[model samples]
Target: MVELPKRHKLEQSNRTREDEKLREFDEDIPDLRSLVIPWASMVIVAVIAAGIVLYNNHCDGEHSEDQLFFQSSDTMVEGSSYKESILERFLSAVTVEQHHVHKPVYEENHPSLFPLTTADRLGFSFVIIGLMVAAGGGIGGGGILVPIYILVMGFSPKHAIPLSNITVFGGAIANMILNVEKRHPLADRPLIDWDLILVMEPLTIAGALLGAFLNKLLPEVLLTIMLVILLSFTAYTSLKKAVKMYKAESRALREQGLKPDGTKESELTHINHQVEATDTNKAGDELLKDMDLQEGESPGTGDMESLAADKADELQKILDEERVTPMYNVSLLVGLFVFIISINMAKGGGAFPSPIGIKCGTYSFWMANGIMLGTIFLFCVYVRAYLVERFKAKERCGYKYVNGDIQWNSRATIVYPCICCLAGFFAGMFGVGGGIVKGPLMLAMEVHPAVASASSACMILFTSFTATTSFFVFGLLDPQYAPVCFGIGFIATYFGQIGLSILMKRSQRNSYIAFSIGGGVALSAVLMTIQSVLSLAEGEQHKSGGICGKDS
Candidate 1:
């Protein structure tokens, strides 16, 4: 009885300490009322999600709703060169609903993994859906696509990496178009970093082309290993940066002396997607001003002053809620490694860029070099112009809070290029626009979140389009993948965008939310990496056996 009392006391003490820690954690996190969704929105979302699940579960035939336009031609799977074990692995997860096709669409031992047979059309649709989701997860969907193709689709690493870039071209295009509409309507005066884009565009183009060319030299197994490593790094960068955002937000809030309202962790915010079709351009703004103007007051007088004040308040609010979480030096250095490797690749990769053009497959060494050198020269000029402008700005006015100012809180001056280089290479190599990766990098460089997202969206479009075109011209891309990848990806992105908007509206979408996503992606990347290594080993063995048989 005496020992039992002592045990109870010890348990009570431990519980008290745990409760205290929980209280501290609660206090540390910010209250984001905007993240809370209403009950009605939640119900609607649940209904929609259930409907989708039920529909997918029941019906599993047809390429899409309109079968007349969608059909497999050159892209159809015909041979049995693809690894069978890997094919079975992916197919095992999916439901085979090709009972309608009585005749076999292709040979049983066909090497092709996708569109298994006329009966396997059901599986192909699932793949399209998966790719769509993957694209939305990564900045341009290319990062996720490569993994899916290799680990799930059972494609050769060389083919998967390049095709990954090509397939998500539609998503990038969609993302770009959306950003354009958002940023470029006169009065909207989108908070774009044009100078930054101009300075970086050349690097992006040169770096991607170089990466694409270099991609050809590596052995298949080596390439898969490299791709896996790249995925891990990309995953880490996304997640780590996200993790640091919470404290940064708190710090920024403290600096601004603004704290959000108190809300329980258990209560999630519900956001209703009530979009009003308003003319949200400069003209509309001016028109609104005109309507608000007093009989004797000019449009420029009081209206401008009020608008300025409102703008300032809005900016301050955003600033107060966000913090400048600079990336670690080690993290930034990894990017520098990528830049150095890019330079080395240009210098050491196979054929020299001779004065006389030399054609290697679809690429001309001299032409590519010439274009790169020209872009480098332009980049240099832009840098000089930027420096002069900065000097002039400093001389004219001392440091003051300006809208869209580059507010890097750490050693970000040299790090920006490394970021651009890594993102560019990855974009070119995989056809993933790297916008998702770049957006976080921009954020790390102290660019505003809104600006970062907008800038990333624009760049993603360019990167994907360039990568896709480059592959197509180089004869590495098949036009067949485009119809499926682009059409489904395009539609998926629209719905994905809407969902993201709704989620953001219902919750405080800050660093924490971003961190969760990055962590999830990184976890997936790790698994894919393991699977890729095994697949590569198995493939090499299979090749060796075939060679031995031929010799015998």
Candidate 2:
């Protein structure tokens, strides 16, 4: 190797350097397919497995929790009043002797709307209108439409839940379309956060299903207590929000250097420049502190830094204030879950409980619908009156009303009614009070809380009507029990209306509904667990006894 020429050796060294650089470059470049494929496959497999597990847990099996299948709990027997215990024992006996022997016929046959008799059709139509009217009345200081429907119609909570849900479904879709097409307010801006809504929906639906099941397993007294507690909480929350709004408004006025009442506009208008100068001075000081450059730092550098910092801070503040983070979309799901758990504890009846056993008749469905529709009509009328009176009141104050014209063609008019119809359809299929969703949608459309609540009532009633019609069409309606359910429901509904009216006058109405629903869901979940465990134990006892006591 020592015999090589000097020039050749130099060339060899240069070649070696080039080779090393090439090797390093090659090392930096990864194999695209080999690097990504395995990880992608793993992710896909994991997702598939998770989905299967969730389906098994929530959707599949003979008694899917989503389908509202549940057994009454053992704890339901505890703390029973003497009268309640006697009634429970009798019901249990009847359930064992009658219901257990003959699986409910209606449950097996999904109903269509074609076979509804003229009387049933008329009755249901009236009820739908009535529900709407009642809802309006409640929100406008009249009645709580939902409870009224349940109590008056004698329609089991399960049936009412779905019926109400369909209305919300329809109404939401309609509103979305109108917002996009007619109003154009939500257009050209990513105003509606789909990500939040998507995340929340499944949770809410799951909660609703669970609530429905729990309703089957629990007792009524516990449900009532939970409702009361929820009502109180809602009232408190509403008041808290109102206070917060007032405080925020006051703070804003003070920041603008205006009087609290904003009566002296001229005195405050000249302070804008002074306020700007003060803000600048403060921002400059902050900049100097951030740079580790003290008060003695070069005046030019300090000034520049302060200006930059001031701009950054201003931008940050603007961003924070302008961001539209929606609480309703996500919170709705949580509330729904709460409701599901609580209502189940009420342990009412089912959507298609044994037709031969206790058919909640067509009239029951009709009355619920009627209440809602009637409420809507009432709301429109009330709103018109309120607007007129408000304008007159303003005139009396020496200020002509600037805007008395209600925008009828605005997006809300179309969106709200549409949401009602869509929500109504699905709700009927599921047998629920789709009002939960409808209430929020109504609020979003800038409807007054009262009107929104009333609209929800109206929508729910129609949904129930559609559902009842379907049930009857499918030969699920039992005529004999119809009168009895309607009579009982009528009283209950009326009472609910009166109670809700009293609450609304105090501005504590909506909260009551929210709290009642949330509490009801939670209570139902507990009751269901208790009932299931007891039923299992009972089965075990019977197995050990070998001789059964003729099944209750």
Candidate 3:
């Protein structure tokens, strides 16, 4: 046979060399410095907790958890002195100074802010730990925070939900501020997926506003059941998706005659990008046809050898890196309306009045424009998002990423905002941050668990901040707890974020861990549902006679 062309041989050799390099490489693992931060953080928090509890216990005389210098009053009824009629409540809702600075006084006849004692010490520790776990994994800590306040501190749901959200705002704020810092090693691509956050934020805030309003509309039992179902589905779907992806990936790699690693399938996908409907190498095919009858003893071997000698697949392996997958616009529009209703409801039944709802009837005077501004901003996000993306007007974050096993889908676009809207609605309606399960849902959609969790952490901040603002607007989040709970919670949450950054950065495969966290959250939701049921049952028992009581 005549010599093969030098150009073809050079190209063939290059393909072989490149493929060998790709097959041999591995990503580097994170080093010791990453471990130091989380360990030190744990020590500092533990020491402070131990010292504070010891000091408070040693100085103050033993007191019951219920021991308070001031007690909450019921049925104030907006007495004859002030005309807080339903109409007046509506007008004054935005005008009320619910966030006034809280004064702490234990002197004669003076009201106290949050009382700090042994019980508070216990509460502070538990709250910090729970939030740390949740925030580290990109949850808002609402899953555990609600139960902490209700069960440990004896707060009613009305009180606990708002307080928990307001408390988590501390952590979210801390993490947001930290996100701005460029000194961190991973600053180039920070954990906060701002691209996803931008799309999800407004919808989530709007939902929180509406849900806060919806808080009083439902019976307590219904809310409990809904949350339990939502959480359970989140956990189940995440585990199921992870397993399915792993198996599919394994099978594909097996067929490809490659040992499975996380990177192999993505490499094959990169190769797939070069495949086209029409054959690309007509000249090469024609040249081979002329040589087809030549050397191989077997007639079949001649054509097979010529086909194997053609190196077109190797040459076309470069992927089309950025592929567009559009999100459904109709779902987003529907979500927008839902968010507005939730927000209005959060304004002390501004949209729909309920007996248990706060009525903000005061005419707009100071800060009344907040709702209007927020509404315009949220609606604008929905309307402008498509235009911005379509025109390539400015460089913004992409809504979806196509990573190894993870990719974008229109369904994700529809499902994601719907979840946010629901979470927001309930957050506003019940004063509880509902995005705690958002991480799991994102994971189920095949996002890298770490990225999903990070996105969750950032998004929860918006949900919590918005919900807390409503609580402040409606006089639900007492300013007294601001310093102790919100302030302290903020510091604790910052540390949690730090710990999370260190932990997530070190892991190469975090899907299993992420799924486990989701499972734990689902279990927590189950407990919350049981608690809601017992609370209703106990109330019924009170209406009837107690077990031991004789008719008086």
Candidate 4:
């Protein structure tokens, strides 16, 4: 009885030491709340400001520049022509007219690429911060980038868009480099789900193409309203998801007889070790009994050979599981990317002069688009069939799955890709990065946060690179500032990834990843809304041009 009490005391003392160790680990992680709260507050304030601007614009009776211009010319019509004029004015009020062509102002008033002014320095600082946040969340940060370039750096919208794309490309490259060798948190395989990428990316590109076409027809104010609504909803959903995950994690820790913030290693490792020992002992006893019952001439030889064979098979299984992603998948994704880029280059809009002279709304232009869509459709069908076959095979073999693995069944294969396409459509229409939208979507799907971040980063790498190349082809990217921005993006993302990894590990909370993702989206929403409101307040008229008009 005395020895039993002594043993209990010993266990209690060890538990105390483990608790102290966990406390020390928690202390090392920085308080992320300090960063998250202020940003959330900013988002709230920006949303209010946007609402005010929208209300004022609605009440002012001059909602668009086209309306004002048409109203001024009303006296030029009389009698029967007056009714026609009224009808034309009504049409112009409801739909943006695409009949005029004007020269771009940037050609005459282009700002210096590497200015040494105070505002330029301040803008660069914000860009660095945005890149770090974006890199950590696996987003491209274009929503943040475009606003800073236009508002602070004195760049016109045309120039700002390209610069943002190139900067995001740099960050995407950094994220891909960091994520490529990362392992899944609970599995022995890679962090990035190549299957998910193969299924989602092609459809995303297709949706982007369609959205880009619509962008030419949509009014600026309408697009702004839509963007704000979408982003605000996404931010709310993401933060709510984060909070739910945090509570679940805390409850799990409490059930294991640990503090909410405590590490699982101490108590959980002890229990696991005990269980493993018991299992080993049981297996050894069974093996000995089987050897005793054997009628073989050589004692223990057959049993030893059988054990070796079993070990070999287990080792081979592990090797197969840990193997690199299949080369065929890599090749297919590369081929799709190349094909998409070629199609875009051949039938370009905006600042990119088309190589094939394919005018928008023309037969040739529509044909190019049709061909692109058809190719993507065929490829998606092939990939879907392949995934179905693989999933069935895994089911037959009783394959085990790790946490956050999405079962790509028939319904999921169709539904998720369709959702991804919509996310991509928003991205292209708003001129934001695909990651800004897709990251939140992946979280909503209940994917593991780390795996979502890594996989999203891979998709951004492809999208951003394509955009950057298009910008480069058009000579829109400023040579002097491009390299500087690229270097900043690359360096910031590397440190961001390192810091985030340490924070997640020390805190024993994967929800921080969700917080990072939510934070980025919220910040983008705030910045983009502010930009839109500022434009409306300044009474800047959007340029009017037909979808098929020559490049200004």
Find the candidate with the highest lDDT and give its number.
Answer: 4
Q: Model 2, 375-408: lDDT tens per residue?
A: 4444434433443453333222222101111222
Off by over 4 Å in 1: 1-138, 154-163, 183-192, 210-230, 246-357, 361-367, 387-391, 394-404, 407-415, 425-433, 474-479, 516-524, 527-531, 540-552
Mark the regions of model 4 whose C-alpha exceeds 4 Å error after superposition: 1-115, 263-322, 541-546, 549-552
Best by TM-score: 4
Give the per-residue lDDT digits (tens) of candidate 1, residues 1-552. Answer: 343444354346445544543453344222211111221233244335434433442244322321111223322233645433433322221211121212211112224435454423543454455444443333555555665655655555545555666555676666556554454211133444544554455566555654553343223454455555555655666666665666675565445444532123233221111111132222234323433434453444454556445544544443332222213322332343344334433432221221233322213433445555575655545554554454333222222233334422122223345446555665454334556446545554545444555566555655566555544544454345445666666776666555554554344345533553464346446655665577666765221101001111
- TM-score, structure 3 vs. true: 0.51
Worst 10 residues of 3 by lDDT: 542-551
- Alpha carbon deviation, residue 160, candidate 2 (Å): 5.2
Residue 424 of model 3, lDDT score: 51
User: Residue by residue across 137-250, what tens digits does model 4's lDDT show?
Assistant: 787788889999888988878778878887877888888888888876665568888888998899888877766644554556766877787778777777787888899978
Model 4: lDDT of residue 165: 81
**lDDT (Cα) of model 2:** 0.35
Candidate 1 accuracy as TM-score: 0.51
Point out the higher-scoring one by TM-score: 1 or 4: 4
14 Cα displacement, candidate 2 (Å): 43
Descending-lDDT candidate ranking: 4, 3, 1, 2
